[model samples]
Target: MNRLQKLTALDTRFFYWCNDLHRDLGLAPVSRFVSRLGDGVLYLLVGLGFALWEREQGVIFLQVGLMAFALELPLYLILKNTIRRDRPCDRLSGFRAVIKPSDKFSFPSGHAAAAFLFATIMSAFYPPLAPFVFILAGLIGLSRVLLGVHYPSDIAAGALLGVCSAVVALHLWELI
Candidate 1:
């Protein structure tokens, strides 16, 4: 088989393994909570809070966040539409996701992308929170898989996209 095909096969197996563990551990409730955190509301609030209440650094963070999301969202939409990959829930036979996905296609999961994007921004603005935010971002990605809506590779792609977006935003903000 070709390399892409082999990768898909392995990804499917890994997905199943994660789903199995999720089922065995009864982690659906926790997964749902974690996944929901990546839905954008919290990020917006945090950014706004920083901009309104915090000092100059907070304002800078909010600005950088806005720039990052502006970049990430467009890129995410283009990639999702271009790739048009089916989610595990849609593609797998006799398997359904624990939660309904926000969008139709799933490649480079938006949740993972948003989570990591915020994580990267937060880390850049407040280096002290790097470990916590990154860990939480990772959990958000893991929650997508545990809930059976995304493959690990999707999360990885999203992570790369997010980190890159944030990096670009940071550089742009520096120029301002």
Candidate 2:
């Protein structure tokens, strides 16, 4: 197999490994909660709450986070469509997804990207929350794999894309 093929093989192997590890009686609820947090609702509430409590910092947080999301959306879509990778649940026979994805293609995970983007921006403004935010973001990525919708590489790429988008947003905010 070529290098790309080898990497793809590795990704599939890692997905199964994670899936096997995910088999548990109690982890389902935890995974569900973590994944839901990455869905943007929690972030929206936190942003709005922060804005109400502290106007200046909250405005910065929302601005940076929303900018990152806006930048990530189209970029993620382009990559997903360009790569046109099938979800593990779709590609692997008998593999089932715990939740239906918003779209068919799955190369880079939008949830993971958005989670990390929000985490990165939130960390920049509130350094103390960095550990918790990143931990949750990491869990979000892992949950995608455990839920059988994404490969390990997809999570990794989404995380990288998210952090990079956050950085770009911060830079843009500084310029303005």
What are the lDDT scores of the predictions, listed in order? 0.94, 0.89
Sequence-dependent TM-score of model 2: 0.95
Q: 35, model 1: CA deviation in Å?
A: 0.4
Tell me the tens digit of each residue's lDDT in model 1 across 26-103: 999999999999899999999999888887888889989999999999999999999999999999999999998888
**lDDT for position 22 in model 2:** 84
Say which candidate scores most in lDDT. 1
C-alpha lDDT of residue 65 in model 1: 94
Deviation in Å, model 2, residue 57 alpha carbon: 1.4
Q: Which candidate is the best by TM-score?
A: 1
- My TM-score estimates for the predictions, one after another, are 0.98, 0.95
Per-residue C-alpha lDDT of model 2 across residues 25-121, encoded as one tens digit per residue: 4466677778887888998899888888889999888877888889999999999999999998899998888878778988899888988898899
Those runs of model 1 whose alpha carbons end farther than 4 Å from true positions after fitting are none
Specify the poorest-scoring 10-residue window by lDDT in model 2.
23-32
